[model samples]
Target: MRRAEYHCAAHHPRDWVEDTGAEVAFSGRSNVGKSSAVNAITGRKGLARTSKTPGRTQQIIFFNLDETRRLVDLPGYGYAKVPVQLQQHWEKTVRRYLEERVSLRALILPVDCRREPTVLDWQLLKWCAASQLPVHVLLTKSDKLGHGKSLQALRQTRESLATMPLVSVQLFSATRNVGVTEARERIVDLLSGQGNGRKPA
Candidate 1:
């Protein structure tokens, strides 16, 4: 539909946590194309700036939509250059938010199609499983793989994370618009409380 209304709601470091209602979080490894996916989904260039350095998004950035919805871009995990203390702080912050935030509706975990699930991904999934929060796996950059390889990758991912409860697993290519419509519709439906089908875990 219309490009969902968006605006910068708040920027919070590990200290100042601002509460937003019914927010959806985007989480992934460092430079796993989370920002690119955000820009693609919103159809706004630079809405979520792409960074050359991994772990550049060191703070939680919240983008408010129509003053009703919030799209949260969480700091990427497993970035090496950042200091250990900062990394620990981010981990704590993200974990606290995920566990405590009542307005959070879902967590969208983006994984690069070329890479297998990392330990960080497993940890995130484990946290979601413990919390019983809805999780979705978005296999980004699907065009990077051949058709057979892409399907294999998706299957492998599903198999590897068999224990985690995921809402859905979808092939997504922001560059090719492969699953953009379906992803968007699914997300919208979920946000509206319509798509309650428990997707394959």
Candidate 2:
């Protein structure tokens, strides 16, 4: 089997409707290294912009792959500097895309390995639950923690999210390329309708 080729297609707000057959949504806190992870998975540099400022991605960015699959980089939520009204708008927009977009296959939720789950993370998870969307938590920045600590963090996260059924979790570090291949393979499987060990419910 060969790897898929990914390229940035366009960036637009949630209201902008485009035809993307199958897509995977990347969701996480601000500056949690979501863009870097996408670039690492695709083996392409500068495909997704890295920003120091939280909530820099105020719109949904779509990367089309081989004219078949799409990788969506959603706007980061819970940034303090962004106005409350704008934040609410972003939340609504993102929620709409996740709940309403017919082509979305799954959501990859990234969380800082060193930090515990936050309120916003739980809120997003709840939204996914309500919409019956499959979510896999990617523990980002695992390189920042020791092996034992990383394992502990994963366990804690699993316990925290125990109520959500069929939630998959993995450790990832874009800089060291840890778990990049696994992530890519899983994404491909999901897009190809071979993932989740069963049909999507």
Candidate 3:
């Protein structure tokens, strides 16, 4: 695939691009390395800007690999110091996009490997489950943990989601280039309507 290029950013659904063609979305808590993972998987440094400050990404940013394929970066949730009203707006916007976007193929959820999935993470998972949307969880920042702890975390996350067949989890470290290939392949699978093990609703 060609390198993804910046397409657009939308703060409201009315600003969203035409909802046609396939796109996968990446979402996670603030400071979870979501941008880093996007850059690693696309092999394009700085494609998605990384920021030390939480709530830096305040809009829905789009990166297109081609006319028909794209990747979306959603505003980070949880732990952002943004105002409550703004957070509520983002929550509604993201939920609407996830539930209604026709071209969205799947969701890529990144969480910090050093910590268990947070309450907001579970809420997103539940939303995906309700829609039967395919979700792949990336245990980001895996390099911070020892090999054993990383594996244990992965196993525990898998076990926690054992009842949710549409959700898959894996350890990833964008800084170390670990699991980048697998994540890319999974994105490809999802875009082509293959991965996820079930048809989207």
lDDT of 2 at 31: 93
**Cα lDDT for residue 4, candidate 2:** 36
lDDT of 2 by residue, 28-97 (tens): 8999988888888888767788888888877788777766677888888778999998898878788778
Q: What lDDT does each candidate get?
A: 0.76, 0.79, 0.90
Please provide, for model 3 over 24-133, each residue's C-alpha lDDT reduced to its tens digit, 9 standing for 90 to 100.
Answer: 99998998998989999999988998999988889999999998888999999996579999999999999899888989988999999899889999998998898888
**Segments of candidate 1 deviating more than 4 angstroms:** 1-20, 196-201
- TM per candidate: 0.87, 0.88, 0.96
> Candidate 1 vs candidate 3: which has greater lDDT?
3
Candidate 1: pairs in clash: none
Residue 187 CA displacement from its true place in model 1, Å: 1.7
- Residue-by-residue lDDT tens digits, candidate 1, 1-201: 245444543334434335544667899999998888787777776788788789888778776665556678889998888899889888888877887776777788899988987998988788787776677788999999999999998898888777765456888988897787777776665555455522222
Q: What's the candidate order when arranged by decreasing lDDT?
A: 3, 2, 1
What TM-score, to 2 decimals, does candidate 3 have?
0.96
Ranking of candidates on TM-score, top first: 3, 2, 1
